[model samples]
Target: NLRVHLLEVEESVDRVFSDDSTKKAVNLLYMYPNGVNTVSSDIQGLTESSTNLGVVTTLENSIEYDSTARSS
Candidate 1:
């Protein structure tokens, strides 16, 4: 299960990653969290900024951003 998701098959691994790279995949045992603090702080800042801007403006901005960033 995890092996397939991790691309344990040789051809699958080769197709996904460069042959010269040292690491092609990591097992659950090696997976670790490192960026939670930075992301949490950014989210808190967005919440505070949105509160100052009011909900209507924030929602309109979000809708405009989504429309601009997406294409048919």
Candidate 2:
């Protein structure tokens, strides 16, 4: 039950960030697809500062990850 709730919250955060008018928040928690967790935001102004550049994979799953960056 707790995991499901957290997943919903993660989705909500994704939606909020996708909005163009939304201001950057101080924190973000992503529940990776395989179950691992991550914290991130584009506030640092990296060259690739967007959700596409900030995803982390869940180590327990075998799904293919497209990003070339190493998964944390």
Candidate 3:
């Protein structure tokens, strides 16, 4: 269930980022919890500019499960 949900979220994010208008408007940093790792925008000088702009976009999922396989 969680895996499926994460996949759906990833797909949605990918769709949004794939748009040309959105890509030009913002810098993005995407992270996944299970297998797929980090995905970042291809903006030039992102590190320097992002730090100067004091803007950050982070997508994180923290799911903790107990030994009984139930969410905690």
Compute each candidate's TM-score over C-alphas: 0.16, 0.15, 0.14
lDDT of each: 0.26, 0.31, 0.30
Clashing pairs in model 2, backbone N/Cα/C closer than 3 A: none
Candidate 2: segments with Cα more than 4 A from true spot: 1-30, 33-48, 53-61, 68-72
lDDT of 2 by residue, 1-72 (tens): 123233334333322233432222212223323332343464343333222323434343222233333333
lDDT for 26 in candidate 3 is: 34
lDDT by residue (tens digit), candidate 1, 1-72:
123335355453223333433242232123422222222354454322111111112231121111111111
Model 3 regions more than 4 Å off:
1-18, 27-72
Candidate 2 lDDT at 53 equals 28
Between prediction 1 and prediction 3, which has the larger TM-score?
1
Model 3 residue 29 CA deviation in Å: 12
Ranking by lDDT: 2, 3, 1
Candidate 3 is scored at a TM of 0.14
Q: Cα lDDT for residue 42, model 1?
A: 44
Candidate scoring better on lDDT of 2 and 3: 2
What is the per-residue lDDT of model 3 for residues 1-72, given as tens digits with 9 covering 90 to 100?
Answer: 122132334333432334664454332222222221223367543332211122234334322222211121
